[model samples]
Target chain A: MTPSLEAVGLTKRFNSFTALDHLNLKVEGSKCVGFLGPNGAGKTTTLKMFTDLIFPSEGESFINGISVQQDRKRALAVCGDLIETPEIYPSLTPREALEMSGALRGMRPEEIRSRSAAVLEEVKMTEWTDQKVGRFSKGMKQRVNIAAALLSDPEVVILDEPSTGLDPRGMAEVRSIVRGLKKGHRLIFMSSHILSEVVDVCDDVALLDRGKLLFADTLANVSQRLGGNTRSVEAEFAAPVEDSVLANEIGSLPEVASWSRADARRVTLQVKGGPAEQARLLRQLASLSMGLISFRESRSALEEVYLREISVGDA
Target chain B: MSADVAPARAGSLPIADGAIGTVPGTIAQAITLSRYQLRDYLRSRRFVLMIAIVVAVGTILTTLVAYYRPVGLIDNANNLYGSLWGGGAAFLILFAGIIFGGDAIAGEFQNKTGYFLMGLPLRRVTVYAGKYLAVLVASVVSILLFLAIVVGNAVFYLGVGAVGDLGQLFESFALALLYLLALMGFVFLFSSMFKTSLYAVLVVAVLFLFGFSIIQSVVLALTGTEPWFLLSYVNQIIAYPLTGVPEHVARATIGRATITNYAPTYFEGIAVMLGYFFLTTIGGLLLFEREEFT
Candidate 1:
């Protein structure tokens, strides 16, 4: 069965406050879909409902067409999840923790042992297999948590802010692990507020704010659909140019919507139109003999869409 | 650098083609969870602390019997067992229930470990039963340790041949086990009621240690009625088998008031324990099932 996760009209309310409101989304096939939302935007709440950690107040969540509310065990049989920052028993070792996870899923002892080793190595925690989790750093424990989620190798994997509390290197390592997960033909539904991480790992992005979904589409399509006809790029000059000289050169270009000096030698430009317009503006700037050194996108296309949609959502 | 990024081989463990291994039934899942949970308990500091408490209580009883050599205690096996085992078994059971079960359910939520366990294919019933089973096993180990010390003292004082009423001693032990069950059920209910381990442990400790006894006394004195509904009242049966059943009620006059004392009969005691075991255990599971991991 092609792995799929669907949330139809899902709503969750804690007394007067709605944590998730009428969320409707369906993700299918083997790809990474980022559940992107700011903090307190109900990203975690939605994932909890999918994994049956919390029940939906209205509508339903389904995994591979099986209703999570009706038959949670069977529906989740093909699913693996790491929701919130789940702590393993401090007394347990990584291997022992993974073994328990496998046993709970009904894997035979031999299978559990073999898969436990494989997953530990996968998360690069083989050296810490027998070490007590109490002795591990936050990053190490998070890796073990991820390894437990992958122990069964289910068709669908859900991760909730897997790098929420990690250092820069730790965050990079988690992103690398997530990128590798996408290669195994599994549908990865990951929630995060980190836009760069999503752009680096997710094939599709779903923006949510204040319990409402603002947009959902592929990364490329999000920029095209919502980014309008303008794109931002940073340009570098070989020498420091005066602000007026730079403005006159950029202002002469019909495609240049706006410009700002980032530094003595760098300027940011907002160009009208798509890639053609951007290329034309780049050429026009180069012909001006203003010592153009480099030109590149200042922010990711998804980041732009994310900021715009989130600000619009705030409104 | 962004475009050059490729999928690394970090989490690409071999994926199973379709569904992973067949998910176990609830019973199997509960057994697996209980086995691991028991291992954790065995390695925990709390387990060591419980052992220490049992040994301390046993040593104090042994030293008192040896140094003083009270005629009331060493004169006969029944008196020795009754004074030591019967008099002290309920307290040991109460301590065991508090130590093993006070934070069993609440810790899962407080520490966020439930987030890891609840995401699996296991049902909430399985998790509840598994933790309860682990707590029961740990409590039983502590109870048995206390009993061993009691038996050791009995043989030293009365001799093996003179140790009286082995049958009655076993009956008391059985009743102690029932009381343990009922007390643990009550403890787990409180644990399930709170999301913080400190609250659960504090509430269970307070109620068992002083709250119920005070309430039982107040109820008996104020109404001149039976405190049969109180677990502390029913627990007297644990010792009654060895001490012989006490009177159902006794009356005394104090100032202008008639004060009443009551003892639960074997049948009433067993019934109340069974009622607590069923009602509180089931109630705890229902609460756990409905609680959201918010």
Candidate 2:
């Protein structure tokens, strides 16, 4: 099946500064693809290019099958976007802005009303419909923007930093709302300095660093591909064992990937293999009178991967 | 243009008739876009308030002037010319220019909202034209209301008298609108060029209010030539009955030499204004087309 959105060798430059460089991306229809990066890593720039907010200085992007650079309007017909800092005429209430957006997108007036009401309810912003968006808090404005985006029932939705300035509950609500959209439309979500949010929601993720795509794959696939001989365990002592003894116990485990005295009373171990192997190693440590405090798999989180890749680019 | 660029059907869905299909027609899109813009303008309370005040002031001033028949050559000249300078024409141009033109692109950039609006299924040109037409319509509406008040006063006070100068009045009013349009076009151009509303307003005001006048005066004084053909110098060309007015020594005015010497003919003035209007608008849009909004 044809991809819903695709970018090949996309590059953008602002005078002397290269904002994006030789980057490639693709999102299969009906999937939520997370874009992960650091500040100035080109995530926003790439999203802008895809939405036709900014032209790619090099390469091309397609929405559905139409080239965004060539037939921008046709390509945009199936797409809706909410970039950073949602804008509306300050005096217009949320409902008014949504109505105008709906009309412009060719929705019938009735469709506009129903769709606005539906999306407002979905975003939990129904009560704020009459309030001017200018008076809204950032999160409220974002919800209004999201409502406008959904008015046309677009086939693809692109959100940049979608959860910025939202409360925890608001963030979770937005996440679920985006997840709900996955069955009917593809989603391209860009976030810098927010890994866990994307990790929880995206089917696939592309990690970027200094305007280049470092890795793009499913979360599990990326973890497997970057597999390392490392694991972590936390062990407690019934009577407070000495660090020396704990270290010695940790050193004795044959599967111990690495060991160190985490503190005077506990030892942390890095072990080879997966969580199962790590669990067995923890049990062995328990036999040595080192009662376990807690244990978790020791590996690179998305944050670590993001930092490591960006630092590498810096070098 | 490929064969695929045919007009769209109802609901704007693509037809797979083996023939090349274009996007929806420009007319439909233009209508929708313009409607959206008009709604925005009307919904803006500040703009609505400003319009109401402008219209009320215009009507009040016209009624009082026509009733009193304030007599003086300049007063009579102002009756012919005051509408141009004082009848909210300049004020409307400046005010509408800011509301409609200043925020055209600058606010989009400053707010970082270009991504949302520009991402829609509309060409950049369509968006620009729709906005321009909407502003033009709004400006025209307000100014026309002001005109209606003036004409009403003329009928009431002048006793429906034959002025024998209806053609001149038409010429003056038409020229005023053209001048305002040209002014708005440059303001739009400046708005597109800058990334802040204040900068756009400041630049346009300087060009029209000060820069154009200063340069015109310098040229006239230095070259001993007629420079009223210049935009700022030709205010009287389209909006006044004054063929001559002695320079006012009590009130300091710049560009005296320029206004006295070389004002453009009505046709020449119209050509210049139209040229500026069309060229600046197209140029502004073209520059905007290639710009990357961050």
Candidate 3:
């Protein structure tokens, strides 16, 4: 099957600012690929180029093998996009907005109505279908925007920060809906800042920093590279304590490789792990009246890989 | 989990517009986009408010004119048509054109929603054409509403003996449509040129209210050129059907008067305005086709 989206040597610039530099990426059909990056790291810019919101300054992109620059209309016809904030007509209800979108894509009226209702229901926005989006809360509007993107049953759906403002419940709803879409269209979502959402929904990830792709691979591979040496154990003190005392205790633990104060009240430990040593470390923290916030004995998460790659630049 | 496991599913690659199936012509794509725009514009509260205001203003102006300068029964049809078409209809379309067309593309840029919209399954021409047609239709709707009010007022004034001149009335209305199209063309051009809606509206307002007039006066005064050379003069070609030909002050007779030569005939004047429309529109599109989102 044709790859749903592909970009080879895609470069875009704004005067002196290089938003995306020689970025190469490919997303297979019927999969979810998370576009991971930090702000000013070209995540939104890349999405813009793919969606043809802005043409690339240097290289080219193709959707289903159609050049984005050479044939914008056909490319856009099958691709549904929600970039940045979903700034739709304030006076339009979710239903009206979707219906309008469906008509633009050449869907008939009855098809628009049924499809719109189904997408809204899938996003759990049926209750707010008739209410004007102007009054919708941020999470509510995001869901409505997602519904609009899905209205035409696009073969490729690209979302930039799709879950930015969603509450936990709303975010989960979006995640599951995106996951369910994995069976058909290729889904390319930019979740640069929201690491957890990317982890939960995306099967693969492309880590970007400073307008360059640092790593583009399966999430599992990226995590394993960083996760093998990392552990996230949070300890909260019952009372304020000196760094020296806690640091000494943490330092003496043979398996502990690094420790960092997450906040004034909590210290997160990174330790080598085995069942016996992991239990001992928990006992030591328990005896000190250090309330355990979280304890995980697992591999590195997307967050760790992201921080590790980015921190190397900072160092 | 196997560390080397590639993602079992690969999302698809980026594709161009109209490639999934077939790319339609620019006009076809534009028309489809315009259909949605028309629906949205009709439902917009601002659009509704604009119609109401135009109609109310037309009614008030027509009533005041009838009461103050009551024409004898002999020329009642001509007199009423003149008052409404010249004064009420002209003014309402001016305002309507500004409201509907002055911010067409600029609004898309300002809201950043263009990011999603410009990426659609059509070309830039389709996007632009769609928006322009929608604005044109919406402006026409407002103008039509004002026309209705004027016609209604004429019926009330003439009462039982009143004979409304349907022929002259329609002629005036057709001319109004041409005037609106020409004027709105300029406004849409400006809308696409600027990124901010307010700036687009302001520039259009100035051109309509002052810029064109000022240019006409200066060109006529200094260069001894016809005022028709100015955009505002061209507009009068359409505006003068309601009011009889405006008397031109001879430039030689008055040292300070801006009038230079006689205004062009209606066709010549329209051609000139059409020239301005084509220039500005092409210019705006060229600029927009290359502009960055930031």
The model with the greatest lDDT is 1
> Which regions in candidate 1 have their CA more than 4 angstroms from the true location?
A226-228, A272-293, B1-17, B162-165, B251-259
Interface RMSD, every prediction, one decimal place: 8.9, 9.1, 6.4
Which model, 2 or 3, shows the larger TM-score?
3
Error of 1 at B211 (Å): 1.6
Decide which is better by TM-score, 1 or 2.
1
DockQ of 3: 0.30
DockQ of each: 0.37, 0.27, 0.30
What digit string (tens of lDDT, one per residue) describes model 1 on residues A3-52?
A: 88888788999999998998888888899999998899999999999999
Q: Which pairs in model 2 have colliding backbones?
A: A257-A271, B4-B20, B4-B21, B4-B22, B5-B22, B6-B22, B78-B82, B228-B262
lDDT of each structure?
0.86, 0.68, 0.72
Tens-digit per-residue lDDT, B223-255, candidate 3: 776776566566555545555566453444466
Please give the range of 10 consecutive residues that has the lowest summed lDDT in model 3 chain B.
B1-10
DockQ class, candidate 3: acceptable
Candidate 2: what lDDT? 0.68
lDDT of each residue in A161-204, candidate 2, tens digit only: 88888999998998888878876634445454567777777777
Which candidate tops TM-score?
Answer: 1
lDDT of 1 by residue, B119-228 (tens): 88889999999999999999999989988898888888778864555778899999999999899899999999999999999998898889998998788667767988
